[model samples]
Target: MSDRPDDTPAPRDADELNEAVSDLGETDTDRLEAVRGRNESLEERLPGDEQLPRTHGSPEKG
Candidate 1:
């Protein structure tokens, strides 16, 4: 029942996450939290439960 394709892959680590985030060109706080929640490495690097409105040198909030 998932909308995602069966062939679609889930992010496995911080590198994968960074790549995905980079491609998006915008920070998705909910998605980042969800991924960080599951990925210890990312969680460790990012830390804190608070949402990150911007990341990876993306544009600032105006």
Candidate 2:
């Protein structure tokens, strides 16, 4: 049930660990882009302003 593949081997040294962490961060950008794309698609499907929640004063004022 883990997200990582079972075949992935553990990093044995500090350098290996650093490399692994760097690699994971690089992959995260791709995942983030996919999430943003999905969010935009869902926003497009949402109802009009009348059906959506309303805001009070300027959001920056808070």
Candidate 3:
């Protein structure tokens, strides 16, 4: 494991790559409709597509 050299792959990135593609992506509902305008619901107790009722272990003992 000393003077070894067999990796191969010297194909330069065709000039820093950028063939052509620009749409100024933003996604995520355009960043929550441009920050603070909405999109913060984390469902603390209910609301936000509620759905919780699985308990199949051992925690309902009181």
Candidate 4:
């Protein structure tokens, strides 16, 4: 079975399914935050809206 329902086939074995689930657990937070940051940045870039802080990038130098 697959966590996702895209065109791709679902995992056909217990080991493959376990591997996929473990991979999700490992990267869930980082991936979610990245999505959130992109969303915020996009909103901030809209015309007539206040700019939001960027989610990524090196800190500015003094």
User: Candidates' TM-scores?
Assistant: 0.22, 0.38, 0.17, 0.36
Q: What is the C-alpha RMSD of each candidate to the true structure, in Å?
A: 16.2, 12.4, 11.0, 14.1
The best candidate in terms of TM-score: 2
Cα RMSD, model 3: 11.0
Which candidate gets the maximum lDDT versus the true structure?
2
Candidate 3: where is the Cα deviation over 4 Å?
1-37, 42-54
Candidate 2: C-alpha RMSD after superposition? 12.4
20-57: candidate 1 lDDT, tens digit per residue: 66743356776677666669776577845356555567
Residue 60 displacement in candidate 4 (angstroms): 43
- Rank by lDDT, descending? 2, 4, 1, 3
Q: What is the lDDT of residue 12 in candidate 2?
A: 82
- What is the TM-score of candidate 4? 0.36
| Residue pairs with clashing backbones, model 3 | none
Question: Against the hidden true structure, what lDDT does model 1 obtain?
Answer: 0.68
lDDT of each: 0.68, 0.72, 0.44, 0.68
